[model samples]
Target: MAARPEIAAVIWDFGGVFTSSPFEAFNRFEASRGLPKDLIRRINAANHHDNAWALFERNEIDTARFDALFLEESTALGHPVRGGEVLPLLSGELRPRMVVALKTCKQHFKVGCITNNVVSMHSPGQDEVQRAAGAMGQVMPLFDAIIESSKAGVRKPDPRIYLMMCELLAVEPGRCVYLDDLGINCKPAAALGMRAIKVVDVDQTLAELADATGLTFGAESVA
Candidate 1:
């Protein structure tokens, strides 16, 4: 592209848009550690508490605690393994699709990355987002802002996190366009006046993105 299109800012999701789901992949690996496939699901359904990931994002918990607790949980559940098993998934499989969007955004307007990620790297079977800054997979190198749950201490479907991202980008929500694979998270952003796109497939999502954001996609570029 000759120059980035004109938009105030653009936000992209990490997992599905990138290589694949490191989150999903990690959970799958949990089986090797002797963790039941449903272990994570049950844990999330029950309390949403006790998990260091939540506290880590709000900046309440540190990396050490997050990692140790994860391992502890696994051992308690009869599955014991080191934390690094999760690292390969995030870095290796999570390819970058929004890189084009990021590149396009930065050329024209401000760009920010808003992801709900763990605050630090400590344990196994977790998305090793600490290296996200260098993860060419998600084109992390191109982001003007990278807000993951671990760092933000919050995940989507929470309006506060969306607003926080807007504030950090210094753009009004109306001027921003956000993309994620999950519609649940997009609802709040749309409600807040930020243009939102649910990225199901790269080309198709790009088409919707171009239409909604008014960014001119090349004739051949899929939405």
Candidate 2:
């Protein structure tokens, strides 16, 4: 078989790829409230392109507006959920194994991150922001480029965001490997000629990264 095309860069999605999924947190919240599973995800998926969650991620709305709007959206879906309640759930615990794989990938290829983050929810001055940075600081500095949707005014599933990362890395799309937790986000990357991996779990993702980059990560406990 012909050898796979050489990969020049590795792009990652921050939240779900590096950390436990916020969807897990959302489900837990839903269970606690006796709401349907995946309700928050459903709400966000509905009218995805122009939803309140999408606007919040692009920084087109402030926290207060997102709160009201998200509540409105959720209420329309059945349960009344405050956006304020959902904001805190977005930060999932970091996965040290994934960080190890990322570090391994960085040694071989240019590394970049494209995250659909919210500006209002992740204000630099917020305590949660400080804590999150402190917790993930070791991994943050390793990236050659980091694009936040809130700052970039574009989110994943939009072709421009993936293209922007390639431009920033000075790499061709066909020569890059991109990993994201959401299939919707992965579609555009794959369409752009990137080798896109939809992350399902740490070990699975690591195994694929290993296959793509031809690198092996240590199994030591860094957690």
Candidate 3:
């Protein structure tokens, strides 16, 4: 029988995994606008590599330009949605269970955060950025390294960024376990030999992490 690979580190995605998924907020925004559900997702996924979302995250485009380009793209898609209207919904409440899981993980393994995020170029955007920073501040100290797309100029699903993270942690990809809400983002990590979990439910993800690392990360751990 082969011995299990020793898990040396755990890498996490910020938005969807740590907080309630922004996708949930996106759906709410679509419904409030009387537009089709998943409209924002479809629009953002249209040109996955260089779309408005990707460009904005990479800081290649400011909020105002993203608003213009996003509206244009949605209009082309038959639903004219304003990017400004959806920006506020980008930040979701932090998940307490995920916080507990993070705490437990840090006790056993090196932890890091890698997020695809945008810069605050305007008012409410600035407010939103501050809010997110505040939420992350509570747990930032737990992370050994933090990488943001806006600052790094590279977003997930890009192999280089994943490699950069492994390099930052000074760990082999095979020795890391990664979690992200987006399956697309998890692909590159898996391809790089990291055990990747696509998070849908917080408990399920925590369970998977515990199994992978042979560490306890249940409700009891939080207590």
Candidate 4:
């Protein structure tokens, strides 16, 4: 049996974790819209490299300014492809692996989410957003806190957001376990003494968390 995790709480990232990152979906949308990947790249400018949204989520750039930049570049990519489409395309479907992890981890430890996300993308959704929100509400009950760049105005790698989540969960940094898809996001958490996990899939993370707490998580019922 796998050992239990030690952290009083486990924090997860939203975009790449609970929800699918519309990476492939964006490519599909682009190809269908006749917006070549290169053109999209040019529109986003250095977003891919510097992670502009992460900065925006961190409130390093005000929403209007960020939207303007994205709109200008995207319009340059395709006049018909408005900046409004950005949110829909970037929101990916939830991964089952992450769901399993969330569902399973919730029972053993306090769970929370810390993510670098855009407010424009996440804020409005009577339709798509609501759909995504519904899905999130399912597993998210597992979390003790939910921290997002859009809402918190601080993104990952910032360290403050990590601390905020720990604060909300009422757990010390050393007693928290943070998981994210990006190595950079994990760096600060690990430095702060949280047991950090970079999620490639989920098996390795589950095993590690299990080991930390000396508990057997996950039976044949779920992941």
Candidate 5:
């Protein structure tokens, strides 16, 4: 292992970072449907690397295929759900404070986003593709670089994705702070020498970012 360097860049995970978590929506969906909690998550976790969700995120499969495949996967677990039904839930409300933190970080350090996102899944009633695009459009430009799994052909928890961001930003993993909502995702970044922050909420994440970057967001500042 190499010696750590002064933080030079900040890498963010999009969904649960800039916006609310889709898991919250998943739980709500499960409750409304009288299904088990974390049911959607359980299906995704079963084959973490090459499951239907993984294939969809990598754009290896289309929405129609994912719909049927996800249903198959879920049914095997006792509860069935079409992948199309889950797409709309992926759209999350953006966090204004987190966006402010990203803008603040940009002034001092290289900022980038690595998101494990699916290609457009135009589910019924809600055009998830359009919703995510419209919201991300305003936020994407704020980053010096952005990598979407749908475009990258690989997603986080894969060390390659973290390395790709470091390459794009011209920084080492040791000199970066990486934030994500999932511990499983954070592990790889941490293993690669980045300071990984598992985001639980807006306040916790912003405070940790300030601590790492010597920056301030909203009323939170680091001394």
Candidate 6:
């Protein structure tokens, strides 16, 4: 039997894992706009690796440019949508269970937060990025490191960002476990030897993390 790897760190994805997924809000936005479900996702996926979403997250495109380009893409897909209409929906409510789990993880291992995020340009004073930072601030002390795509110039599924997180945590890829709600984001981490958990819900993910790291992360303890 293969010996179990010594898990030294736990890396988490901010948008989906720690908070509710923006995709849930995306669906609501689509329904409110009377567009087909997953329209935003389709528009995003259509561009994939080089999409407006990717560029915006990398800080290569500013908010106005992203808004125009995103509108164009949505229009091309037969739905005229405004980026302003979508940006607000991207910030999901933080889950308390995740916060508890994070605190528990910090007791036993190093924790890091990696997120694909866009620069806050909604107004000269406030935007989603600021709001997100504020929301995460409560648990910020628990994390050993926090990486944002807009600051890092790289996003998930690219492999480099995962390595960047590992480097920041001062942990080897083989000695870490990563949890993300998106399978696409988890793929590269697993490829680099990090045990990856695809979070479907708080319970399943915590259970999987326990299995991976041999740490008891039961919801009851955190609750």
Candidate 3's residue-wise lDDT over 35-99, tens digit each? 89999999988988998889999999988899998999999999998777777777778787888
Q: What are the lDDT figures for the candidates, one per model?
A: 0.64, 0.86, 0.84, 0.68, 0.87, 0.83
TM-score of 3: 0.92
lDDT of 4 by residue, 35-134 (tens): 7765544554455434445556666766667666676656654554544566666666766666776666677788888766666554666476666766
Find the candidate with the highest lDDT and give its number.
5
lDDT of 2 by residue, 1-223 (tens): 2223498999999888877898998999999999999999999999999999999999999989999999999999889999998887887777888887777777678999999988754556556556565655767789999999999999988999999999999999999999999999999999999989999998788778778877766555245
The TM-score obtained by model 1 is 0.68
Model 3 bad stretches (over 4 Å): 1-5, 121-130, 221-223
In angstroms, give how far residue 6 of model 5 lies from its true place: 1.0
**Ranking of all candidate structures by their lDDT, best first:** 5, 2, 3, 6, 4, 1
lDDT per residue (tens digit) for residues 88-206 in model 5: 89888878788877888887888999999887732335665577667788899899999989999998789999999999999989999999999999999999999999999987987
lDDT (tens digit, per residue) of candidate 1 on 61-161: 66566567656655666665444344344543534345655565576777777775553432333344545434643376678777777655677667888
Give Cα distance to truth, residue 222, candidate 4, Å.
4.4
Q: Candidate 1 at 110: error in angstroms?
A: 2.3
- For candidate 6, list the clashing residue pairs, or say none: none
> What total of clashing residue pairs does each candidate reach?
20, 0, 0, 13, 0, 0
TM-score of each: 0.68, 0.92, 0.92, 0.74, 0.92, 0.91
Q: Output the worst ten-in-a-row residue range by lDDT, candidate 6.
A: 121-130
- Candidate 2 clashing pairs, residues 3+ apart or interchain: none
Q: TM-score: which is higher, 3 or 4? A: 3
Model 3 clash pairs?
A: none
What's the CA RMSD of model 4 in angstroms? Answer: 4.0
